[model samples]
Target: MANVQVGNGVHRKHAKNQRSPEESVTEHESTSMGSDYELNGSTNTEVQTDKYGFIGGAQQTPGEIDDVPPDVLRQREVKWLEMLNSWDKWMAKKHKKVKLRCQKGIPPSLRGRAWLYLSGGKVKKEQNQGKFQELDNQPGDPKWLEVIEKDLHRQFPFHEMFVARGGHGQQDLFRVLKAYTLHRPEEGYCQAQAPIAAVLLMHMPAEDAFWGLVQICEKYLPGYYSAGLEAIQLDGEILFALLKRVSPMAHRHLKKYKIDPILYMTEWFMCAFSRTLPWASVLRVWDMFFCEGVKIIFRVGLVLLKCMLGSPEKLKACQGLYETMEHLRSVEPRYMQEAFLVQEVIDLPLSERDIEKEHLSQLRRWKEARGELHCKSPPRMHGAKAIMAAEPPSRQDLQQNPTIIVEASQGHDSNIENGKRAKKSKTEKNKDPNSSGLLNPYPLATDQSQGLLKEGTLQGSNQSLSSAEHDTYL
Candidate 1:
C-alpha cells in the first residue's frame, strides 16, 4: 500500500497497483469496514447497530446509554410537537419555555424538524425556494468537487449511511458540500465542513441539510471556513482568554506548556465537536448550539478542559505537548457522557457577552501581534433566537440595495454597530416591550438574568468534577 497525504495531515493508503478513483474508493470502503452495511439490517449483517444507527461490536466501548424511559420520551415528544406547531408563538412570547425545553433536550423523533426550526434553516429555505436544487444541478468548481469526493467516505464510516463508497449518504453529502462551494465560491470548500454536512444528512434530506449547512457557515459561524481560516484562529484566542476565567489551572497548564489553543480546538470548534464527542453527546450539544449559538460550543470546550486538566493530578500525566494533545484527542468517556456534559454546559457561567468582550480583546491583541487580518468578517448574529429577533433583511432586499443602512435610535446602544457599550437614556431604561426590536418574551427573573453572567461562578450547585474517580483517556 502507498500512503497519499490528504488535508490536515491525514493520510489515505492506496493499493500498490494503480486503479481508477471509483475502484480505489470502493476498495477502500470494502477493506476499511470488512463489509458494507445499510440503514435497515440485512440478512447477512455482521454487526448489531444501536438506536442511532452506529454499528455496535465488541471493539467499540459503549459511552452513554439513553436512560429515559419510552413513556417519558413520548410525553416530551408531545410537548415538542406542540412547541413546533406554535413555534413562532413560543419563540415570541414563551422563549424561556423554549429555552428550557431545549436545555432538557429535544426529543429524538422531533430533533430534525426542531433543528430546522431552531437554526432558521426552514425560514431560509422558504425565503429562497429551489435555490439548493439550482446549485446542485450546476457543475461546481472542479477543484472543490474533487476534494469533496475524496472526503465523502471519510465521514461516519462506522455508521451505515456512509459505509458504502457511492451510497446515497455519500452522494447526498457530495451534493450538499458541492452546492455550498457553488453558493459561496469565494470560500470554496474546507475539509472540516464534510463532517458537519454529513451529520446534517443523517437527520434531514439533502435540500434541508444544505440549508442547515448554509445557516451554520454563513450565520452561526461566519468566516470559519473561509480561506486562511482567520475567523477560527481569532476564536481560538477568544477561547484561551475565556479559559483564564473558566478554568485557571487548565489555562495555566497550557500556557506553561506553550500549547496553542488552535492546536487542539480546531477540530473541536470547526466541526462543532462532531468528530471529538461521543455520538449522543454530539447530538445533544448540537441541539443547544442550533438554539443558542457558538456559546454552546465555547461552554463544551470549557467543560472538557475543566474536567480533564483542572486538577493537578490530571495534569501530572500530561507533562508535555504530545501527551496533552493525545489526551484531548482521545477524551475520557465519563467526561463526555451526554447527561453530565449537557448539565455542565447549562451550569457554566459563560455567556454571549463574555464571548463578545473577549472577542474585542483578542482582536486588539491579534492586530498588535500580527498586523492587519485579511478576510476578517464582521460577527454575525449569535444564535437562532438572536437571528429570529433581529429579522435580518431578505435576500431580495439586499439584491435591490447593496448597502442597507441601520439607523440607531438616539441615546440607544448598538452593540452590533461598533462593539462599544453606551449608556441608555432614562426612557430607554424603562424597559419598553417593543423598544429593542426584540419583543420581551417573558419577565426576566432577576437572578436568572444576571446569575450565569457573573465572573468566576459556576452555577447549578453541581461542581464540574463531582466524582472522585480519575479516568484517563486511552
Candidate 2:
C-alpha cells in the first residue's frame, strides 16, 4: 500500500513537468543554440551556430583581392610601347623613300602630343598641375599671365565665338592656344598661330596642343614671328623669288597684272599652309616639316605653283590673271591634296637638296637685301650725334657694342621701313612727325580685316575626312 502511494505521487509530478509537442518545438527554436525563431512575429533569415562556427542564410563570397600580380600590368605597358614604336619606324621609312609617290598621309591621331614632342616641348600634364600649385613661387608668372590673358580671345575671336556656339574643334583650339600663351610668355603673341593652333586642338587635348604650339614656335619655325616679323617677310620674299625662277611666264603674268602673291599667301606662310589644305594633308606636310625644316615650305610652295601654273591652256581661260589663283583656291577638295602629293612634280628627295641650297641663297639674299637688318643679334644703337645724323649704322660702329638708339622721335628708326616710307606727304612731312603712331606694316587688324578686337582672357578639324583623304592622289 505504501509503494503504490509513492508511485502515484511520482506520476503526478512527471505530468506537471511535461509540455505539448508544438509548445516544446517553439520554445526549443526560440532559445536553443543550434536553432532560431522570431518572438516579435517578423520573418527574417536567422543566424545560428553550427560546426562551421557561424552560419547565415547569406551566401559567402570567394577569394581575397591581393591575388592578382602587379608585374602583369607592367608587362602589358611595355608591349604596347613596342608596338607603337614599330609603327613609328614604318611611318619614317615610308616618308623617307626617295621616289615615293606623294599620297595623303594619315594624320597621326597622336597629333597633339606629337606636335609638342617634335617641336621640343614637354607634355606631361601632371607637370602643369604641380606647376599651377607652385604659381605663387614663380615670380614672373603674373605679368606673363596678364599679357597672355589679354590676347586669348583677341588672337582667336572667331574661334571664341565659334566655341561659345558649341562648334566642335573651335573650343579646344582656343583653350590650348590660350593656355600655352599663358605658359610661355617669350612667345607672347604673334600672327599665323591661329590656324595651326586650331588644327592641333582638333586632334589633341588643349594643353597638349599648347605645348605643341610652343614646340613649333620655339624649335620648328624659329624666328618666324619674333619681334621684328623679319622671318615671315624673309620666307615670303624667298618663295616669290623661287616662283619667278620656276615659272618665269607665270611670274611675269603675275607681275604684269600687279598680282601680289604676298596678299593671298601671307595667310599660308604665317600658318605654315595649314589654312589651304584639309587638316590631314596639312599634318602630312608638318610631318615632313618636322623631319626637314623651313626648306620644305619653300619646296612645297615651288611645287604648288608649278602645278597651278605649268600650263598656259589650264591657266589662260581665266577672266583676270588673278583668276588662276582663285581657281587654285577653289579646287575641289579631292584634287587639291593630290595636286600637292604627286611625285613626278614634287620629287621629294631630289627637291630636298635643292631646297637646302635655295635656303642658303635666300639667306644670303636677305643679308644683301636688308644689310645689317637680317642679323638676329642686332647691334645696340645709342642716340649719339652719328645716330642723329640719320646715317646708316656702320658695322664697325656696332662691333664696339655700344648701346644704340635711332631717333625715337622718328617712328621708323628701326630701319625695317626706310624713313622715306614713314615720310609724310610734303604737307605733313615737316610737321610734328613724332605725333604719328609708329607705322606697323602688318597692324594686327585692318578695315578690310575682320573689325573685331576684344582683349583675350582664354585660349581644330575632322571628318569629311575620307573624301579629303583620297583627294590628295589626284
Candidate 3:
C-alpha cells in the first residue's frame, strides 16, 4: 500500500532520436480481466486484479481476494487496452521516419515489444527489418547511407575489428552492431554498446541483435553514453552505501586501510559487470534490471555485498585494489548464478525483510555513534590549525610537531654540586616570588645549553636518570 520511489522513471535519449524522456518506472498492480460477479445476473467465474493488468491476464501468482469487483475492472481494462493500442498506432506512424541508436545484447524477448511499445513502433515499424533493410540496400536516401558509412567503424566496431583482427567473436558482433548503427543514426554509437553488442551476438541473429540493440539503447541504457555514466555513478553510490550497511566491519577495515570499494564496483556498473561477473550471471542481473528497472540494481548490489561478506578469509586474501576486484570478478559466474536461485537461496536464512533489519541495525548504530563532534581538541597540546592561526612564535610548533625530540641525560659529579646551588637559589627565589610573583625572573630554558659544558659526551651519563624516567620528559 505504501508506494514510493526516488529515482525518476523517464530515461533521456540521444538528441536525434525521441526528443523527450522515456518513462523508466514500472508499477506493479493486480491483474485485470473481469470480476466473478456476472453483469447480466449470470454466474461469472472471471477474476481480475489491477496488478495483472499489463499481461491482460490473471495474476500468475494469486493472492488473497480483494474487495473490488473483477468483472468491472476487466471491462475497463479491455477498453483501456483498446485505447492504448490505437494510441500506439498513432504514435508509431508519427515517429516511423525518425532514426535512433541500436541497443545491446539482442534485447530480451519481452523487451522487444516493450521497446516497440514505448517507441510507438508497436503499431508500425520502430523495429522493421524488412523495410529498414530495403532503405539500407536501396540507395535513394543519401543521408542514411552517408551517416551509416561514416559510423561504419566509428563506435562499436566489433565486426570491423574482426575484419581487421580476425579473432573469436568479433565478426558477428561487428556485423550486427554496425548494421544497427546504420539503421539508427540518432543513437549510432555509445560507448557501453560494445559489451552489450558482444552479448547480443550470443542468442539473437545479427538482425535481431540490431533491433534488440535498438531497444536497449532507447529504453535501457538511459540517454546517451555520457548520460549512462551518470546512471553508473548513481548505482555505484547506492552500492557503496549498501556495502557499508551490509558489512560494516569489512567497510570499516577497508576505510581504515584506505581502500575504496567504489573503485572496484564502479567499473562493475560502467561495464555492466560484463568483465567481472560470469557471462550468464550478468544476463540474469540484466533480466532483473530491465524487468524491475533500477531498483533491482540496488537489490543486486546488496546481494553482491552479501556474497563478499559470506567469506572474510577469501576477501582478506585479496590484498590490492585490483586484486580485490579480480577476486570478486572471479566468483565463477555459475556459482554466483546458483547463489541467487534455488529454495535454499530463498530460505537461506535471509530475505529482503532481513536486509531491512540489517539496514535498520546500521541506522541505529550510526545514530548512537560518536555523533557528538566537539570543537575542543587535546587540551594544552598544540594542533596544526592553532599553530597556523597563532602568533609567529607559535609557528615553530608547526615544524616541531613532526620532529622527534631526543631525551637529554642528567646527573653527574660536577653538575651535582652545581645542581645543589641552583636548587637552593631556586627555592629561595620561589619563596620571594610568592610575595612578588610579577618580579619572579623565570630563567629561559635554552635548549642549546649543554649543562655538562659539552655536547654528546659520556660525562653527562651520571646525570642520566633510569631509562624508564628518561621517556617521561619527552
Q: Which regions of candidate 3 are displaced past 4 Å?
A: 1-172, 179-188, 257-262, 280-283, 310-315, 318-323, 332-335, 339-474
| Stretches > 4 Å off in candidate 2 | 1-117, 122-162, 165-175, 182-186, 258-260, 318-334, 338-353, 374-474
Residue lDDT tens for model 1, 1-474: 112111122122322211222443444443222233432223353555555656542223353454578677646765775665556767879888888888887876567767877888878887888898788767778788789888987888777567667655676777888889989898899999999998887777678789899989988989899989899999999998899898999999999999999898999999999888877788889989998899999999999988999999999889999999898887898899888999999999988999999988998998999988898565676777797877643434212110112445554464335533333443454654334333232232555334322522323311111111111000
Better of 2 and 3 by TM-score: 2
* TM-scores for the candidates: 0.74, 0.49, 0.38
At residue 465, what lDDT does model 3 achieve?
A: 12
Mark the 10 consecutive residues where model 1 has the least summed lDDT: 465-474
Instruction: Identify the superior model by TM-score, candidate 1 or candidate 3.
Output: 1
Task: Please state the error at residue 373 of candidate 1 in Å.
Answer: 2.1
Q: Cα lDDT of all candidates, in order?
A: 0.72, 0.42, 0.37
- Residue 88 in model 2: lDDT: 32
Model 1 RMSD, rounded to 1 decimal: 18.4
Q: After superposition, how far is residue 96 of candidate 3 from its true place, in Å?
A: 32
